[model samples]
Target chain A: MPVDHKRINGPENTIPYKLYTKLNVKSFKEALQDAVKNGVRNDKRKLDEHRRIFMKTDIVSQAKGSAYIEIGNTKVVVSVFDPREIPNKNEYSLNGELYCEFKFAPFSCPKRRLHQQDAEEKQNSIVMKQALEPAVCRHEFPNFQVDVYALVLENDGSALSAAITCAGLALAQAGIPMFDIITSVTIGIQGDLKLLDPMLHEETLCYTSINKNSKTGKNSHGIVILSLLNTHQQVTEFYQVGSLDIDDIEECTKVLTEANKVVVPLVEKCLAKHVIKGVKESSQ
Target chain B: MTLSEAEKTFILHGVQENFRIDGRNRDDYRPMELETSIITHAFGSARLRLANTDVVVTVKVEIDVPFPDRPLEGKMEFFIDCSANATPDFEGRGGENLATEISNTLTAAYSSNSVFDYTKLCILKGRKCWKIYVDILILECGGNLYDAISIAVKAALWNTSIPLVKSVTIDGNNVDMNVSENLSDCIKLDISAAPLMVTLCKIGDHCVVDPTSAEEQCSQGAIVVAISKGKFSTVFQTGGGSLHPLTLMEKLKLGAKVGNRLEEALSEALSKIKENGEMGFLN
Candidate 1:
């Protein structure tokens, strides 16, 4: 007798499994238009508007410095440790090192994540390291390495951008000398519509190509995450998923850079509060 | 963290005189704060802070096949991850050894049927059962890790809400379970018989219940005793020191006495916890 795998092993499927079934049942073009129409997105935000941000510093007492950030439903916490001598490197170098580790708690996302860091998490860590290396004064502490760990407590959308923003704030709070602070934003492109700080549902729809006309086979859909050094007006790191036209890419980049600027002031205000508190404690 | 000879003498004399550095008696514990149902996505969750040590536990439930030998029983697993935020030494894979040690100790303590009833988790005797995954994340380590972890695990288990099985239809090796659709239709686990572990650190000729990091370094040996109800469920020795039989027996007696009191205090705290209270790292 042949065993029925669908009946026995199918109970463990997650929400994504149900989502795929629903997608196949409906017309793709109709859903796309419903998500974006009449100068507003599904969440009732304007085309270029970003989500509300809440940020704080010195949340984790164990770490040397820490920050917690929340944008809409996404929550991220970053902790920075004191600088230490680079391990397993017998020879000395002039430039200091920055080690980044990005992790999502097992219960952070809709689907359960494994305890070990997956490949996507490793890639995000490298992106974070590259984004902050130029802004940080690595030559200040020769032969030493600073460790930064970012953990996502809840991942609704744009989690990597939140991590980058929080990690930079944590490093500054640790008193590491930096040329300037870095900020990041995510942009979602679908057809002629551009969504800023898209939610989880909008993000998934943006990634899936829904060609209004199947005969043309032409679809412009992608997600771009960009980190910017606002003080210097330079792009530090850029990552994109899926395919988009050259013209659409340029349009998305311009919108994301402007969005990044809106977040810088929030970060500055949080850091200023932390500094004032420290000065007050030392004087007393 | 090396201590000089004079510093060691100070700690030894302090323990002998019963005047600890923090002014606590031998069987006293530090102040602890506990919050449950913190993680929104998990079936059950809890966060515990014992002075400087912080631990978060989340429980996830899934349907799984019962073991061939034990058809009526369910399964429970413990996974521990030590975050680098606690200390630089736990970076990367460096904390694997400590994580393994803590998880193994928990597995041993929960292995007995009397300590935690596994049959309550069963949906269908020989076909399907509920597998509980208890994931523990250690954010900080001050000392007395075993005692802190055991208490947090018990509290998290108490907070767990397993979905009620409305019906189970079996058709020739195919089992289909219909769980209750209402969110409030769930069963809370009965954790009264769950074991509580107490770490007794022998300093000089006396033993202490909660030892700070400095005192842990000065102690000669330590014994972790897990008590379920009035009996010992599991007892094990740790650290690099030898213990005389007489002193070992004395420490075991002290551990049992402290374990019972700790269980009573924990259950009291759990009962006082209000539903929908403010919970998380923010406060």
Candidate 2:
């Protein structure tokens, strides 16, 4: 691996001290079982309830459009830059291309992240681009490229969905033509319990396959993230990990779609506030 | 590759008529040839050729400590390298995006423990474990890269023979193990539940599997579904276009059906493979 001199690099193989702590020494299966008690999450949220979201537009003055969003402990900021000519391509493109970058702050997670984008971040970038592309009117700005950057300040959970939601807001704030507002949500399934908008710890537990105690060989556990265009009722991007039956997936999608609907009005209200403020300023 | 508008329209019309540019129908796949144990140096390797698309997958294993969170499970990683020989666009870091996408998909597809048992690879609980590295090199790109790569990976894994461990002794923080030196004393991976990816390209209101480059250019959207043991291990939407919920569900069902048939065909072909000498790119 190439050394990054720009930022202070930690020791080559420094594990998080939390791993050695007594509280976390227990097996993940035990921890997973303890995550939810009496239909309430560790953080005291309902099984299908989402964390309160705080959103603001035009936070970054330098960018053409920018939005900052916070869902519980997860904080993400997205910025959209003005359309520019394609960098290396010489051929004329019939549709505008989107360049998306998803990054995590070095101190975002429990463990220190590298300055460079890792495999997970790169994959998230592609997912973000796919989720936002269908909503953007690429034909409106043919032969141009729009750059979108998402930075996770603190990743508690559902950072990718938060970034997707923020990116849509940023694009709308930038006055980019769009079909509809794009909202995204993540659902984590563990056995028969489904946790909507899973926190970081809950997400990790769902990702680990530790249903050895179950009598049946099949165990349902996974994380599903879906991005929806509200007006069109289309799924722009869907990504899933872990083992899930088709029936489980069908139920999860239905739950996720409803979860996305809950977020649509919140996002629209934020954008509406921005629009109303802009109109008031121009009128004054 | 860039296609002319006229060509795109022609392909679109063909898809609408249920006849592809090639003689194959919408669901039919091109002829594919698979060869395993091609790389002698690697523990296991396979090369697959699906018409103009070519992929070489090699599996190498190394002993390492398991993750603290999931100590009972070993690790499996997928790495993709797009050779410049396949296309000029893949030179330098140009292929990084495509490489990352394919590797990520493979990673997710194989993440399920039931699909490829990770506990079998663990030598000791919370201690030593085998980390399998699946490196895929794309020698050519026709289209339907996901399906070809996944099939080649499964074949390579099937050919892999993990060295058997005789015993292990741990003292405080130090650990030692005895591995069998006999070449024949090895364990084979149970890959029956290994997932196979099928890409369903939506073109002109119809879905097609194993599309060629020409047909790929005409697709409005594409869904890559990874099926393992008749269950969905992963489902991803690629490309720029979006699809309605109904269309997405329809394509997922179609992909699963095609994936199961392809899985059967591949396993049968794998069983028929003989230890033929002097095989590879040379042959």
Candidate 3:
């Protein structure tokens, strides 16, 4: 058996199938204009509207705790494993550790992704860990490590924020002690237009500087993702990209803080529903 | 690397009093030494030393095809390597997390077209372009790695020179181009809007810039703000602590203020630096 069998063979370079579609014939500028017209997006959502969210817990039977969430076309599943002894450590630790892994399924995006984690996924894992660390009471399980794995089944946009929210729910479902429920939101900025919970197309438009304003040199374009602990009113994680003015950042923060509130009630309701179901089954 | 309770208390008290172990104020940065063109083999190179932290950055370029979507723009990447010489824990894959974080921050900061124009590197639309690889090596880690790395990367980019393309001809599916043979006939990168990162470590109720390792341990949370020109390119919160929204905004303000001053100082230093004939590791 002299064949190279370590990995499956594939095309040297594969372009996304979406690129060959006839619907993508228009120029990007015209497409961007069509994405949002007359204060309404192509999806008919308002400028500050968020995509409908569906969340559920206890999806993975093998895992200690698991959650699945869907924000429009983007779907993510997060599983949390029980705390185990920390690996390769001899001394005691004052606080427990969290191991986060964020992965995108091969068929999740428009283009096929590799099995191995890419740089973007690795960075998302770190952000996920940081976002959840403050809410978890790590001192209770010192010298132990809890593993949280997030898999993006479909990535339309705001996948990281969805994963963070799902991970928080999974941690809570796993009986992990926490200070408060965490909710995250993403906002896309393009010039003066601010879209809340943007889809993939709007996100791309905001990312690119196609319509840059050169006069002021203050290009208000980028993405701002904020994770908030509602109870304490503390921000667990804040990640931003692109170039923006100070006032724009402040406004974005304010808008994101408010936007985060929209998802808190939904998360709380889901957890409460799960708890009641468990109680009913036990009573029976 | 572990500090005792007494040592922690001492540092906390010093922070509360607006004084630090190194006798610096809340916003005071440690003295820095910067040298450019240290790597003769690299197209451009720079080494920056801020007190105990040290970093080296080099820029390399190669001819490559541009992305289909953005054919007018070239490509740029940031790769950070944390050497074991910086610390024993960085051996093998231990430093990968930190390396990825720093590199990702740099990528986000430079993603904006206004920050660094990529179209200038394109030799032929959608066919040929120059792909720049900025490699950074962390020789030591005292604290404030982001700030130090950003400064070195800016300096290296400033020192970089791209070879000019003489001409290009496309026939059917094949393309041919002639590059300038003259060594001095090259175009320099425009680094005027290059972003520089400033880490604001929140200690007690005050935020400090350029914190030492000891000071980093005593902080609650920190924010890294990358400023380009007068606007902010990226703002990231790191560490395992949470911050109030008010405190976060205040830290951002402080970071911007300090970043402007840093940008000014860096420009001043860069202007004063002349291409010295004798410059290398031996110096």
Residue-by-residue lDDT tens digits, candidate 3, A67-172: 9999999999999999999987767889998999999999998878877777888889988999999999999899999999999999999999999999999999
Off by over 4 Å in 1: A1-284, B280-283
| Docking quality level of the chain pair in candidate 3 | high
- lDDT of candidate 1 at residue B86, scale 0 to 100: 78
For residue B194, give model 2's deviation from the true position in Å.
Answer: 1.5
Q: After superposition, how far is residue B15 of candidate 3 from its true place, in Å?
A: 1.1
lDDT, candidate 1, B66-154, per-residue tens: 77545678999999989998777688877875776577667766765556778888888867899999999988988888888888899
Order candidates by DockQ, high to low: 3, 2, 1
- Model 3 C-alpha RMSD vs. true structure (Å) is 2.5
TM-score of each: 0.50, 0.95, 0.96
Give the interface RMSD values of the models in order. Answer: 27.2, 1.4, 1.1
- Cand 2, B chain, TM: 0.96
Go through the candidates in order and give the clash count of each: 0, 0, 0
lDDT of model 1, residue A233: 75
**Higher DockQ: candidate 1 or 2?**
2
What's every prediction's RMSD, in angstroms? 22.9, 2.3, 2.5
TM-score-wise, the better of 2 and 3 is: 3
Grade the docking of candidate 1: incorrect
Q: Evaluate candidate 2 and give its CAPRI docking class based on DockQ.
A: medium
